[model samples]
Target chain A: MSSEIDIKYVADLARLDLSAEQAEKLQQELGRVVEYIAELGEVDVTGVEPTAHAAQLTNVWRQDEAKSSFPREVMLANAPGIVHGDLIKVPRVLPSEEE
Target chain B: MDLKKSTIHALSRNLKDGVFSSEELCREYLKNIDNRDSEIGAFLEIDRENMLNAAKAADIRRQNGQALGDFDGIPIAVKDNICVRGERCSCASKLLEPVKSPYDATAVELLKKQGFIPFGRLNMDEFAMGSSCENSAFKQTKNPLDTSRVPGGSSGGSAACIAADFAPAALGSDTGGSIRQPAAFCGVVGVKPTYGRVSRYGLVAFASSLDQIGPLCNDAEDAGIILDAISGFDPHDSTTLPDPAGGYADAARKGAASGSLTGLKFGLPKEYFSGGLSDAVAKVMDETIAKIKALGGEIVEVSLPHTKYAVAVYYIIATAEASANLARFDGIRYGSRQEANGLVDTYYKSRGAGFGDEVKRRILLGTYVLSSGYYDAYYLRAQRVRTLISRDFEEAFKQCDLLLTPVTPQVAFKFNEKSDSLQMYLSDIFTIALNLSGHCGISIPAGIDEATKMPVAAQLMAPALGEKVMLEAAAAFMK
Candidate 1:
């Protein structure tokens, strides 16, 4: 797991621009967290079912359909910066964005 | 008529009886907040105009004999993560800087319908991510009891505001102790209802499975009233239990005088006291146990063998779920969008710039755990351990009516004490197990630690939907 993780790789995947300082700090922190989690390697789970939630719950979902939504103006009014009519615009995506 | 130190139940009763007006309560609390919030940083935003209008409307309803709910004319505070219509719900993160909720969260709607005049959003750890409120991107919420220490968090603001008497009652979400832990720290009562008991609709998702909205307040009875008002099955959240809603407030009020610890078997998990606990905490807890025993409660030592794995298991599952839940926040929908010419840049710039450090760390860890090669080894294994954790509780409950544990190992720490991520994670050890077990948990101020003079919380846990029994036990402790 420690092939000296490429900062650019994670940054690209996360859509973040890491200042060299922040990257250095994150690289250490992330590496430590991953290594600590790797300690879970010692636990043995041969046949246990993976429980998604603690509750003995299943098939909890709302029907798919349009329900109540907030007023359009109120929703759009909150945009720090917005566009004409229906869209809230933003900057174009960069090519090096994560997959 | 100081609203800061009063209970919601008291304030509401007074308002109904004309002992005081709703407008007066609102004005008093708003003034208190205005006076103190700047230094304590407990509030994210306070809407003076909206708050006044709501209070005035509540007053009119009262005059017309049209009080909406028991909480009408009461000022309530909410954690930042819960949505309030047309109001900014930042979740204590810069990512949602200017983000406003188009609709109110179900809990918020319930409060409004009950005639609760919403005051303002409280601060919390960014995206409900940390144990100490320090992780909030905007500002840190300090403990009202001791300013140097943290207000237990990610509901720190909720707890602190209530503790400082800025709000009579506040709503907080508990995912691995967010509500209860802070309640303990701030010397208030915090309840995390049984999983599926409360609707999660409109709550900003944290760890979806662990997250449940509950109340933090001055007394268990008030917590009960708030819980009764906001709880029940919601079509918006299918995870809500199908059981009928009952009056938790009535249970609390009735139990206050009659509830006895007599014949109640309290489960004491050996794991909770083994090590890592402070001496002062252990002493206070044992003394409290003695007090309960004197009151006729029986203590039985029980073992949750899988307790050791709870922290490890929780992080994997919570972070994995969080990774998925937070994915929707990528700039295109409601928040800031970082710009680039292509699609990738947009996603990258928005998330990269939008999310804070702690959030990024979780996303990265979540992605890694759920990544292809590690999915079976990490994520799958964590789930299996989660099952074992739940089993431990099930087994313990068979011998005891309720389980007792410390809310956290120590009192609230200094803001900078937990710079290391692992250290911060460890602080959640006692609280996370319940989240994994999915039981109802509540924290009440046990007493102050003699040395540090900070509050130590006594946690009470009951079997699923055993909120009545839980309240009974907490009421006994308070008495």
Candidate 2:
């Protein structure tokens, strides 16, 4: 069973804010899903290799040359906050105490 | 002549012969959308001027005797998740509400190269997370066949547009059963190519491994045409398979010409037909099977024992990857943002406000499974079982050329009918395993349920890179 605390912890890990009501609801809902998926435990997969991707692709190499990219203006057009018309702005990271 | 009922091939012929100009065709479709979209809600956004301008260009090219190909000047809708240059690619999510794509997805670019003008941005389940269009943050897309019921999703809008004649055909991405399920509900043909058969560049990430872009169209041959146009290798997406020598459209044409499937063998998994199937759908399946047998195809009983675990296995791996993939949507980037005191608050506020409930639930579930103690038990175990499911397909394929199954347990259900998330998840039971196995599948309209009059569909799945055979069989069945 997934406790409310566990659901809250997972929500934090996912960088999502859940209201107490939402967290409680998800605790019950996701607990059911988790319990259902536990059926996989009955399968014998001792020697089976886990497949991250179905396609058998290796690293594809290309010529080491610069190609055109989306224009700076176009790329920055959708940025929530921009500085100097080209750079994306973000909230400050370092704390005043660290400084 | 109602252009809405016409196929791409037929429309292409009309354009080449100058029966009417591409501009006229575009205007006609735009007018149709204006008339009908209020009720169906298929298109999330329509670029009327852009579509008109492109249609005018296609007409000019035709007048100059330099038209691109048979498909030139035909307007097609695109699911909003696929990026079109200079257009919004929202994936029907609030997080991407402010984002406009700077470039085209490789598939869309290829269609443009063929002089195909993209018509509209269709709606979908937000972030392609749910089984119904109700999960779309924007609006619910109603089933064209029955307005009271849902258009199965996350490609619900893509399928709905085609069924409503808003566009001749559309592109959709399937992770689990998004494309096929909706296609089944809407009585259109949908195809999910073998994983990596179509390039994934410019498509917003969901479950990277399970996600594939496919076409939903009125019939199998049109699906082949769209599939041929969008398929092939792109340097931008390394997972794409090298271009195959013979195109899927060509194979479909050949199969249609042959007029028989005398030597073709189709496997029917007993597990699919045994339980959870509604009588109406089973009756449709029986008729479709008989039709195939009459076409000289042989049906053999085969078992995919792990089929029962598909939905469970799918949720774990898909959500885990989604949790990781969606972490990039921080407020600092191009989506809707919420200002807050600190970085952590910004992340929380933006995501909490941006994502719908289903997306949040899946993300939380994903985070739980991939977290410290649970990784080995849930995430790793699901991955290993995914391999076992893939092997089940391999074993089944050894006995037959392709496998046949029901696309869904029943026809389209009414809005708010399946309030339970687990029940909604179970709606995709028959179609989910194909994604896990990395194979190709198509859903073609089989029949309409007598009681509800909604469409029922049958699915055909083939092994990896077996699109030609799969499409040929579909063409034969469609004929």
Local distance difference test values of all predictions, in order: 0.84, 0.89
Error of 2 at B384 (Å): 0.7
State the weakest 10-residue window (summed lDDT) of model 1 chain A: A1-10
* lDDT digits (tens) for residues B393-427 of candidate 2: 99999999999999999889999999888889988
Model 1 TM-score?
0.95
lDDT tens readout by residue for model 2, A1-99: 332338878888999988999988988888778888888889899999998998978887878999988778888889899987678887766656756
Off by over 4 Å in 2: A1-5, A96-99, B243-246
lDDT of 1 by residue, A58-96 (tens): 877766897777667776776545777767765554434
Candidate 1 ranges beyond 4 A from true positions: A1-8, A61-74, A78-84, A90-99
Model 1 DockQ, alpha carbons vs. true complex:
0.50
Best by lDDT: 2
For candidate 2, give the lDDT of residue B383: 95
Candidate 2: residue A21 Cα off by (Å): 1.2
